[model samples]
Target: MIDCGRAKRPGWSPSVHYAGTAIDLLVIQNLDEDHVEDLSELLRTVTVRSVFSNPTVTASALASMKPDGMRTGVSTAHNVLRDFGPGLIGRWPDTGEVQVVHFYCRFGTHFTETNDLSLATFFRWGNFTILFGGDLETAGWQMMLRNQEFQRLLVGTQVFVTSHHGRENGKCAELFQIMRPDIAVISDDAIQYGTQEKSTQWYRDKVKGIPVLGTENAYGIRDKRHVLTTRRDGTISIAVGAWGNYLVTPEKVQNELTLGEILGAFGRNALSKDSQVA
Candidate 1:
């Protein structure tokens, strides 16, 4: 799992229950309350093999830096990291053809902010490539860009999960010049803050638009979207095939029960009842 933040509408508990399997790895990107609020609950429910996070962020350090309310979540995260130990920095196991490379940023060195210290993940399965920039901000991105290996990994990223939930602060033009993805996904709630709303167009401009499933406009035309957001797209599921061909399917779609279809079903039921009576 990428991040285990709690949400009222699209909670992770239901999906985890339905899967009926233990989580092999849990990657905590940001140390903020929104990201780690349900950390303790998640640990209690599932048997996670390994956890990957910033090693420098200890419970005591967090308690001192963060507010009082964030103590519980921080404690849980700290305990888990201490117990499991941070997962290896290089290639992860059991992935088959999928190449998974985790890039770690040194905390309390160049940057001390939790967002800047976020872990960046790169995945390449066949031709499909995905880059998850955790919650890294502009400075963090710029710092990572200096690494030649990191730059090489960003070459053919088809799907890029926007950092800091597509906020303006996460926008890095220099990084965009290196990695141009087909679709930019922003995993965030509805527009509660200005940061979420302001950078919509900027992210769109960064990526080449991809064909979005079930997003036909009013004119019966399927719209190609450059950006996909949890606020609008709900749970976004990307299924990549053996040959690297992939499909991006959002949970919420434009497919609704039409009046004509409803009436037809009703009429069919009525006819069946009449025949039975006869």
Candidate 2:
């Protein structure tokens, strides 16, 4: 019920959606035409009810630019806040389902655009936490890693959606060591981005180490509740509607798997004597 994504370019209409049917809660991550697109039609077409975005230098620069260019983005973004109404977008405090909002309230050394200033959110149910990054990259990640608030707020994240589709620009080893999420979910359609094998392997070997689920890999295998990368072509299903679009939940692996279970398998000592780096 946030910003809805629409046809920004050809081939891909938006993420997890079809051009006319899918409505994404467009949390504007950046102003780079790729990430930011016409919101008026999208919001009205999808009848999106709300939105959330990080107030970044993009806003500041837009403030300085022509009024016509900034009107829709600012006004639409503002409307979401005004209508977030008296209650927060998260669940009631005591509820196990928690959607905590993390903002870049302060500026970074080179923070610019909603992209670098993209708002990152997390959902925590029990010990399981899933992060949905609105495209935050190196500068943004750096800001987060250095901030005391961010550090305290992000001590233990179970999963992360890597920013900028795991672009080489922001793949900092330190960020990985700090956040240390057990899994990384990259909801990317690689055809548009280019070869994903190399980049995917880079993070799998060095950063996430746990397991990576790409929208590209589509299949399900369950063993001891561990993550199994599958070929994700027809297996993944998505539905678009005025209310919202739904993607079929990734199938459980052949063996039962859980975050903790996977972590256990990767202990200092495994079935074998020890683990070997790829």
| Cα-based RMSD of candidate 1 | 9.8
107-129: candidate 1 lDDT, tens digit per residue: 66666667887888888987778
**All candidates' lDDT scores?**
0.71, 0.46
lDDT for model 2, please. Answer: 0.46
The TM-score between candidate 2 and the true structure equals: 0.57
Stretches of model 1 off by over 4 angstroms after superposition? 10-20, 56-64, 67-69, 82-92, 213-222, 254-278
Best by lDDT: 1
Q: In candidate 1, residue 264 scores what lDDT? A: 45
